[model samples]
Target chain A: MELSVIGKYKLLVARLYGELDHHGAGEIREAIDRELMRRGVRNLAMDFTNMGFMDSSGLGLVMGRYKKVSAIGGRLIVCGMNNNIRRIFQMCGLQRIAIVADSLEEGMEELDK
Target chain B: MNKMRLEFLSRSDNERFARTVAAAFMLELDPTVEQLSEVKTAISEAVTNAVIHGYDGSEGIIVLEGTLDKNAVKFSVIDRGIGIRDIEKAREPLYSGKPEMERSGMGFTIMEAFMDSIEVESAPGKGTRVTMTKTVEAEDEG
Candidate 1:
């Protein structure tokens, strides 16, 4: 998987591409965490618009990041999930912990509120 | 029915390969996008279980088999590695055998949700086999 992280205004936006599975989660997690720590970013927004496939591992990645951000009084927003990904998120009850948005713009707006 | 089987090392990198092969094999069924995604997700979960829980970071082999019938598809992921002792507890949502790894423990739950039926057979010292099936609704031709 490929990931791009942009940090601004104390928020980090990660755009993930390709499939996310156990094989890729560890590296992605480390990369994101590095960015989060280096920039002292508070809130996080994950853009899944280009992600074509995900499984339970994706849930683990999101949950782990949520714990990290929330512990620091930051918010987590997951945006641009396809119907299939959304189903997995709902099945895992991810909506309970992370803010679900349709797009990155919407997620940023929610973080502002 | 058309059938195919693939055996690969239980490495983390092979997880995506296994699921993608399953999806390609199921194309014979001409499943809808949603149906394909569901089957792919289920395959991913089962293969991941074999890689992570079954082998436990050690190198082993994972066998993925796919069968396509008139309106349904079946898949089996098998591993000859350490198996779960308690199937019931393992199937529970949010129950990770390796919590330190930050696993969501939703593998079995996702498999059950996407597939029409799921069956798991394992012996603690023997191995584990997960079989899942999904029925595809035939779309009307225009």
Candidate 2:
């Protein structure tokens, strides 16, 4: 798994590459968490554009990060999800917890709110 | 119907390998991209469950057997690990036994959603077997 963390304004935009399965989830959690702590960033924006596949383990990664970010009064946003990933999110009822935006700009706007 | 069986170690990385195997098995049917993704996702979840939940941190053998009959495919993932005590509760949405591990507990939910039918059989001390089937409407079929 590859993670590119871009610091845009106050949001930490994390772009994930490769498939998001059990193996990828571990690496991503550690990398994202370390970056989040290093920058003291609260709001998180996850970009799944390059992600080709994702199982429920991807859901755990999102929910786990949501818990961490919300604990510190921050919000979590998601964007650029493919149909497969979006269906998983919808089936798991993640729309209530995480804001789904069409683009990175829209996700940043949601975080700003 | 053509059939094949595979046995491998219960490990996280094998999830992708297992999915690839399933996808290859469906190549003969010429499934649509969407149908192929659904089957691969279901297989991934089942294999992952065996590695994480069935074995419960120990190494074990996972048996993946699949068969293609016309336009439908049937497969089973068998693991001789710690079997679930409550099958019904386990099938519920967001009911993961390993909450601390950040498991969303949507494994069964996703499997059921993507496949046409799923049957889970298990005993507390024995093991668990997940058998699922999906029928694809080949684009070339009249």
Candidate 3:
């Protein structure tokens, strides 16, 4: 439920912590979108290192954000998910639309490449 | 074999609590981390459906019951809210009735994926009950 946005510019790195569920998804989405708008960031890099758990709601949040970022020709990078979280993403076929990175640094690096 | 039942107000906060309760109840089954995660995720989805879809934003009571038999855990989420009009359609992947809230419509899919079997029963003006069972095939290494 906790989110902090750091490293500005066109590519913004968003660090999310705690449980990622339906109740937390709304606030996270609004916060990230608000930051994206305020900074005019075209690319997004999400860090889920501290995320403890996520459900189907988490998948929807990612897909929705991907659609929003892609609409403007931007990309969303996801990284630092545990094995369980990664399995959920894979189950939802998210690899086709989003980039899974090994770390936040790698995700931010993708923005450069 | 053991059985436990809980009834709570249908609320988003209860989703996490429900998951925890299910996971705790399965501790006796000696589920692996993966099995526990899957069961917790499935419970979250089912309880969330009862709160979100069954009640349709209204306040209602969600009943969660868990039973442990051998290596399998069987649980059911029940709510007497505005029942789903179409059970088959509701079970479809990515067919959420509430799109405005950005619901992924993958609740059922997640339940099915994480559990061994799922049975949904509902009728208009009645209630919807989702029963699912998962067998902890892997024993947790002590």
Candidate 4:
């Protein structure tokens, strides 16, 4: 999985064209970690719009990122999560830690403010 | 497509295979994009547990099997590793054997949430097997 930077927020939108299970989680984690460290940025957006699937590994990735960004006093937001992925997020109570928005623009706005 | 089986090498590898297996098996029902994700997530969690805690992060094999029936899809992962002493404890939220690995211990929680039913069988020092089932929307209600 590869990531692209959007604006001031290093928007790491992973294509997630296929499945996002344990195998892909590591790669995506690596990409996000590198970009976040390089940019010295905390504001992060994970776009799951195109992602076909997510497992617990995906949950671990989200939790790890939340800890990372929180440590640096930055924020992590997720946008365009499908129904199933969204259900996982809600079950894990991730909504309390990470902000889930309708769109990347909304996520960016929430984080920016 | 024929029902399939895949033996996983590492937890990472299991994730990819699990997603594919679940997707392919569930495709028979022509589930929505969302339903596919649920099956994948459930399968991923079961397989991850087999590679990681089920084997204590050591060398072991995880057998993944998938089947599509008239009502729903079923996936099972079997591993002969360090079996869990207490299944109930493992299923609890935030219960992970390897905290240092950055695991949230929410794997089972996610699995149960995504799948319609989950059944686990295990014996200490022998191994563990997790069987999860998900029904398509059309066949969900009685």
Candidate with the greatest TM-score versus the true structure: 1
Tell me the TM-score of each prediction against the true structure: 0.96, 0.95, 0.94, 0.83
**Per-candidate local distance difference test:** 0.89, 0.88, 0.87, 0.77
Model 4 regions lying over 4 Å from their true place: A1-17, B1-11, B57-59, B66-69, B137-142
Judge the docking of candidate 1 as incorrect, acceptable, medium or high. Answer: high
Which candidate has the highest DockQ of all? 1
- lDDT of each residue in A1-113, candidate 2, tens digit only: 44445456556778888889987798899988998898887788898888888999999999999998999878888888888889999997778998898777787777656
Least accurate 10 contiguous residues by lDDT in model 2 chain B:
B133-142
* Residue range B8-62, candidate 4, lDDT tens digits: 6655665666567668866878897677766766777887788777776677888
Which stretches of candidate 1 lie above 4 Å from their native place? A1-8
- Model 3: how many Å of interface RMSD? 0.8
- Which ranking of candidates, highest TM-score first? 1, 2, 3, 4
lDDT of 3 by residue, B18-114 (tens): 9999999999988888888888889999988888889987899999999999988999999999898999999998899998888888899889988
| Candidate 2 off by > 4 Å | A1-8, B140-142
List of chain B TM-scores, one per candidate: 0.96, 0.96, 0.96, 0.88
Listed for every candidate in order, the interface RMSD values in angstroms are 0.7, 0.7, 0.8, 1.7
lDDT of 4 at A59: 80
Flag the better candidate by DockQ, 1 or 4: 1
